[model samples]
Target chain A: MDIIKKLEWRYAVKKFNADKMLTEEKLEKLKQAFNLTATSYGLQPIKLLVVQNKELQKELVKFSYGQKQVAQASHVLVICIEKQIDQKFIHDYFARVQQIRNTSDEILDPFKGALVESFSKKEREEVRVWATNQAYLALGTLLTVCALEEVDACPMEGFQPTSYDELLGLDKLKLTSVLVLPVGYRSTDDMFATLKKVRRDLNESIIHIP
Target chain B: MDIIKKLEWRYAVKKFNADKMLTEEKLEKLKQAFNLTATSYGLQPIKLLVVQNKELQKELVKFSYGQKQVAQASHVLVICIEKQIDQKFIHDYFARVQQIRNTSDEILDPFKGALVESFSKKEREEVRVWATNQAYLALGTLLTVCALEEVDACPMEGFQPTSYDELLGLDKLKLTSVLVLPVGYRSTDDMFATLKKVRRDLNESIIHIP
Candidate 1:
């Protein structure tokens, strides 16, 4: 498939065809895409919340700055971060590494110890920024996957996170929503779907240091 | 190609085959992908530096915490953010939007004005965080592209950016290095290539709200 052509076809859909829904197969690909996104040190500290119920999606509209796409899309995806990246978190990651790679802790301890110590010293806000960056990374990956699969998506960062967290019950789950993506199909009348995408010239965007 | 298989096949290479180089066509695709990456407000406040000079790559190794991949990969990509995202930056973006989409300022002024006003009141640190997040998003899009194209890449965040800016002469360009990715072929001797991928269980990673 011509990737650039597909990339060109995607836009931040301003309006979605509420009646059109993504197929189960299409939704599954997106879930797998997020799960496989590369995170810092492979310490995957992300959770994807898929909200499909119409009422819930409608409720999210206000939190999402009144974006109707939230209620219209086949599914609204909330990308969240772990509340804490403490020592226990590091230990669990190492355990998974050992289980998957069968590497002895003797070989992992130095790195693990360093990570634990590093995280211990980091300010809570610092860790949040770090984790939030990973969430943005996941959004990038999911957006690419959607474009390739011809699924419509509008990624929103203008929403109120506090309201979303409270409404979605993310506080109790230890997941603070950092990014939102509503995916499905674009309404035929959505003028944005047909507009030329605006990007700085690639020549200006990239510098080659030879 | 099965995208999932491609994603599964990719791992962050710890060592790269120094002799192997990416073809010009392959590198161009990457450049295009970054240019097309979805950014917040489509502001495009990021620049990618492609470092291909062997001597320069070797020089970056020290700043990158002695990571050999920096020197060994065919090219080291430095992802950077614009230091000042002020009103002038916002106006230039709208100018591009108008030029490309043939949309009149009459229709764009309110939104553009709000962005200008919004940015005017934001603290410098707040602007930096927003732009840096865009850079992270670019990194994610580039990583996914690398995986699909079978290019081995190692994304590094544990580097000294001040040194990078000095060595790369980025201060003059108003760019602040935020992330790095070394991309090329993985060395056969790199045992990490064969290790099983470690990710949280999909069932646990995804929460469905119906």
Candidate 2:
């Protein structure tokens, strides 16, 4: 379908045109898209940090292993996970579910209690891994949304998370960055933009069990 | 902009209509979409297993913790990762890159060698975690494509992966399933089809640093 065409046109843009800024309306669409992304158990434990200040973007570049795209792009999107995914998080999630669907506690309590109990027993690292996975899902969704909008984006995981957390004051916010995406328009001089995408053949990537 | 509408129209379907099946042409689109999903470092370490056999689907339901959607969907899509992601995998990836772009070995070797050396030094579990992250990215893309195509899908992580690997003989292929997606039409009687989605407010989920 046309989706494939959009996907084909999308690449991990390396050089962004910093002069071109995304309009407020387009940014609103991205916000809605991030909010709409489906998360594990609908917990939605991830947050998107939109960096528009050029000074802060420049500071982020050092933590990003000198990847200038973080500073050069119109906006840098940092995906972060909740620092503490405790019982309160679970309870708050179920409260929203109950409020939105108007479902009875009788119907929600069993599932809600089970999740709260199960997550409470898990180790911190285990919970972090689970939350991190959800962030990746959101990243994937945002990448597609950018593609369809004809917005150039570079999905990155090469940054120093601890440094990012320190610089962005994410620790105080109780969030840790897991993924970063630089979104804007591609520069005319970006040679990598014209390079053919390297992908496995369809037969190699998909196995049919009919 | 239209992508947001499709994203809104989509939901994690609870029950699928068993009588309706995805057409071959539509399935092909999904195959292309999966192959085209961007992965970390362009390694594309994930694989898609498309199971259409009714008997196998029935067997898979038990492993899926009695999730009837597993058996009821027209096809079950299992996202898997390579059992061993080492230097060989990285080398093969760069080979394909060179072949596709007709780039000189001089241009590809430095990046290729660095990736091979870095991944080879990582622990097995670390590599598995990295590969699994890529699988989630692919799952995210697949969910969006399904939405845009108006094909109902339930992106699932609630299944037993060990059982799936044993049943599907994925061990023989040196692969492990990370995520499962049941794609089909939603059943009319599914109560969840009408429920409003519970999501965090846009302001709460997004931090704007201007």
DockQ top scorer: 1
Candidate 1: TM-score? 0.99
lDDT of 1 at A41: 89
Task: Please write out the lDDT profile of model 2 over residues B1-210, one tens digit for every residue.
Answer: 388888888999989999999999889999999998889988999999999999999999999989999999999999999998877888899889988999999988899888888987899999999999999999888888888889999998999999999999999999999999999899999989889889988999999888
DockQ of each: 0.89, 0.88
- Model 1, B1-210: lDDT tens digits are 877788899898999999999999989999999999999999999999999999999999999899999999999999999997988899999999999998997999999999999999999999999999999888888998898899999999989999999999999999999999999999999999999999988898999988
TM-score of chain B of each: 0.99, 0.98
- C-alpha RMSD over true interface residues, each candidate: 0.7, 0.7
Question: What lDDT score is found at residue A200 in candidate 1?
Answer: 93
| Candidate 2 C-alpha lDDT tens digits along A73-132 | 999999999998988999999889988899999999999989988998999999999999
Which CAPRI category fits model 1?
A: high
Per-prediction count of colliding residue pairs? 0, 0
Give all candidates' CA lDDT scores.
0.92, 0.92
User: Model 1: which residue pairs collide?
Assistant: none
